[model samples]
Target: MLLADVVATSAALAATRSRKSKIAALAELLTRAGPGELPAVVAFLTGQPTQGRIGAGWRTLAELGAAPAGAPELTVAQVDAALGEVASASGSGSAQRRTVALRGLFARATQDEQRFLFRLLTGELRQGALEGVMVDAIATAAAVPGEVVRRAFMLSGRLPVTASAAVTGGERALGEFRLALGRPIRPMLASPAESLEEAIAEHASAIVEYKMDGARIQVHREGDEVHVYTRTLREITGSVGELVELVRALPCRSVVLDGETLALSDDGRPRPFQETMSRFGSTRDEQVRALLLRPYFFDCLHLDGEDLLDAPLRERNNALRTVAGAHLIPGESEPGAPAEILESALEAGHEGVMVKSLDSPYAAGRRGRAWLKVKPVHTLDLVVLAAEWGHGRRTGYLSNLHLGARDPDGGPPIMVGKTFKGLTDELLAWQTKTFPELETRRDDWTVYLRPELVVEIELDGAQVSTRYPGGVALRFARVVRYRPDKQAHDADTIDAVRATLKG
Candidate 1:
């Protein structure tokens, strides 16, 4: 298919608020796509390159000065190939090579295609549809159960690859996607609870365990081969050798363990999250020695030749304890012990505790309420929609931020609230320097941004509002930190903000 066809479809998809329409548009495109073009097509429609993170930042994209072609002639494969060069370009003259490649690619695209390409390369499609909507579209195009496609996508950690298999071989193809040893699947996520008691009430029989403030890790081991992946499925086995060695000594020949890893202080208390990340994100040997990370296994998704993902929490916990032994995170609260567990977790300097239904199965990639995380203070990952120049001592800086929560439907993020609080001088300077690069358009009062950056914000709660498009606004929202580790796609949805109001 021509790249313009997909771009046109994306424009149509973005124009609608109905998810059904978005899915239909995508499904129609998939039905027409050649087998080889499926991956590129899916990637383009989702606003991500098949090559992934081709180092084309806003600065790099802005440098690709090309006039749009009056007519479209570029093919999807041609664009994919060009992006591949951008991804592969490195070392001497790489920047120049990438510039040439981007210019050439954009020069052949029509005006709409150029606009679409700019959004796609910058990782903000704003097409009102992404992986969630695409899942159903893939299922419709392939004539398979949505759960089957969802399972395959979760296991492979890539929807494009999953869609390819589904399109080519249907159910039989999706069946091939299993929890393979040494392959990491996306980690199961938790919903926020209003309080520990509320979580306990919802679950009835619950396993309350410490919710550690650490990076999530999924370990897969097959004999001598061991691999560890982060929440986003980036392999980190090389940097954290100590973790690999720990799993290597386990009795099982092969296993898939889901857990949290953090660097503990000398007193055995968990260190600050930044301290853990300093070692987690670094490759320096000295940093490793300074802050050794320890793994606290929570759930076992696979053991030997068996897949425990279908098993309930009770069964999975047993298997996890059997395999992980002392490495398992202790669940001090069972059934009626939610309050006690919360206290213990707090006393230990941990963030909070997680309440899980005993019989719930591991729903990987699904952020359902089967697992409820309760923290003393509420926090949400919100998208920065705009910024305002500061006055007084903060003048000459973009100090105040306009925050938006993700729209659950296939739509742009809806404004929830705004805040100027909790920014350091360094943060103000960074925002002043960076916001203009991400600018879509601006007014005299607010410099609007493309919703691409995720900011972790702490809030008192949320209240029904007439001022925001979301119909609610965050109360006393303050920036906790700028989460460079996350993207706008990972921000908390409006539903979550409303949940707080409901509570």
Candidate 2:
């Protein structure tokens, strides 16, 4: 298949606001892909090259000012091979080599194709279609149920391979994917809950565990050999020798444990999240050893010789405790009242509690309500100072609200943060039409609007920030809803936002 065809489909997906239309366009592309081209097509549509991260970022792409080819002649195979060269280029003169290859690659692409390639390479595809939408497309093209595709994707952890199998074979081929000893699958995620009482009300007798603010890890062990992976399934076996050693010493001959890794102070309190991340992302042994990350085993997906992915949480916790005695996270199943447990978590300076259904199995890659994370929420009525032009399905609309907190000391509103999450297409259309009418000025990327639009934002808390002029920023901020009845004067004060950062 020609790269131009793939680029055209991406453009179509971006232009349409309908999810069904996006799925149809993707499915059509899947149908047209030959066996050899299926994997490359899947990767490109998902806004990535088959060779991930190719050592190039936005900075590297900025310098490659290659003119586009007058005509389309690039094939998927040819483009993928060129990216492979860029991905494999290393050491000595990789930057120069990458530039040489990227110039040739982009020079052959047309203007639209060049835009698509930039988005794909810079990890800013902005297409509403990610792996979730691609999964549906694969199912539609393969004539398989979405559940079957999701299950296979959960186990395999590689959508490209799963898509190839779905295209060539059928449900039977997808069924072949299962939990293996050394393979790392995506870890399960939890949705945020209003409060502990609310979480307990939904999951009455649930497993309430301490929700630590740290890196999520999945450890796969076989006898003495151990491999640790991050939440994104990136292998970190060599960097974290202490973590590997801890998992290796488990009582079980083989195991697959899911938990969090963090650097804890001598008082047993968790260290700052950035301190843990420092070691987690480090490649130097001394840097890693400076702040040792201890793993707290929570769920055992595999124990001894058998897989427990299909087992209930009750059984998995038992397996986890049996394998890791002191390393198990502090939690209980129907052991006490939810309020008391939450108080203990807060007193220990931890993030809140995660209430999970005792009977639910390990539902990897899905953030279902079976597991609810109860954390204190901080809501603020903030004014939208400005907004940026949207991309992909949000094409001609205004997205990414630039939120600002009111300064009651007779000053302009302080810009706190920016967020594009939780905005529906309807909201996007309304903002696009309204913001221009209220525009104070116009720039290339953002529309400088008068702070007349008030938005109610939901956030976890605030943290000291270096980026925003406010000296503090909201953490995990998302637009809950727009406050049509409220005005800019009703917005929360900057002091209120900064107060959440303490205690």
Candidate 3:
């Protein structure tokens, strides 16, 4: 298939708001892809290249003065091969090699194809080809059930491979995927709940576990071999030696355990999140020993060669306890009063509790209501420094807000973070109208505003970050409402944001 066809499909997807329309367009595109080209085509449509993160940033791509080709002659396979060369260019003069490869690829692409390739390489493609939509499109194109494709993707952990399997052998090929050791599957995610009582009400008999403020890990052990993976399914077995050893010591011959790992203080309180993350970046023995990560396994997906992915939470937790005896996370099953569990989790210096239905099977990669996370909502009145232009459905409106915290010395509001989450259409309309009125200057993407509007923001907490002037950034921040009654000076200070970082 030509790259122009894929670019046109992406444009069509971005130009519409209907899910049905997007699926239909993607399905049609998929049906036209050859079996060998299906992987690259599916991956590119999902705003990623088959060779992930080819070290080509916007700066490098901008310097390439390659003029666009008058006509579209670049094939999907050709582009994929060029990107593979760029990704493999690593040694001394790798930067120049990558530039040469990228230039060669871009010279053959038309204007639209160049734009699509730029966005795809830079991770800025915002067309709504979400994984779920792509899965539906693959099923539609291959004449298979969506559930079958989704299950294959969950087990395989790669949409490209799943797409190829579906297009080639249909359901029979997809069914060959299973929970294999050393290969990481996508971790199950939980939806946020309004409150603990509300979550308990949603699940009559549920297991309430402490939601630890730590990194998510999935460990696989077979005999003496153990592999650890991050939530994104990236292998980190070598970097996390302690975790690998811990899992290897388990009595089970082979198992897949899902849980969190974090550094704890001497008093047994969880350390700040940055401290836990720092362990992943360093391999020095002293540094590793200084901040040892302790695993708290909560779910056992496979135990003793038996796959429990389709089992209920009750059976999985039982398997978790048998294998992860001392390492099991603290929780109460069928608690008489779940509010106490929330209070206990908070008191333990952790995030709130995760309420899970006992009868619900482990739905990997899906954020359904089977598990709900109930945490205390932290709200701050922050000043809006700027607003960026929206994309796709949010086009023609001011979207992503630049949040700033008050500087007590009155120098200026310190930029803490930016967020486009939790914005309703009404809020977007209000912002589009109100922001320009307060605009001090305008740029291509963002409009700088006079620090007059104070917006109430809800967040999980704040974490140490070097990216912002405040030395701290909000985590999971979303708009609660506009605090028009409050002044910019009344907004939360940098100290207040820093204090939210747990010890």
Q: Tell me the TM-score of model 1.
A: 0.93
lDDT of 2 by residue, 1-503 (tens): 99999988988877875778888989999999998999999999876799988987665676799998889999999999999999999999998999899999999999888988987886556465667678899999999998889888888989999999898998999988999877899778776675787788886468889898677889999989899988777788877889988888778789999998889999988886657766755556675567888888889998888888889888988888898899888887766567777789888988788999988889864558889887775567798989999888887888988999976432447899999988988788889988876665678889877666788788888899999998998888998767543445456778768867845
Candidate 1 stretches greater than 4 Å from native? 283-289, 386-398, 425-450
lDDT for predicted candidate 3 compared with the true structure: 0.85
Candidate 3 wrongly placed segments (more than 4 Å): 283-285, 378-503
TM-score of each model, in listed order:
0.93, 0.77, 0.78
Best of the candidates, TM-score: 1
Q: Each model's RMSD to truth, in Å?
A: 2.5, 11.7, 11.7
1-503 per-residue lDDT for model 1 (tens digits): 89989988988898898999988999999989999999999988877889888977776777788999998899998899888999999999998888888998888989889888888887667787677888999999999999999899888988889999999999999999888776788778898987776788897577889998777889999998999988778788877889999999999988999998888888889876656655556565675556789999999998988899989999998898899988988675445676787788889888899988888988765689999999997899999999998999998999899998887765788899999999999889999999987887788888988888888899988999899887998998998777655667678999989887845
Q: Please report the candidate that would top lDDT against the real structure.
A: 1
Candidates 2 and 3 compared by lDDT, better number: 3
Flag the better candidate by TM-score, 1 or 2: 1
Tens digits of per-residue lDDT, candidate 3, 468-494, equal 977888999998767543456457777
Best first by TM-score, ranked = 1, 3, 2
Model 3: residue 108 alpha-carbon error in angstroms: 0.9
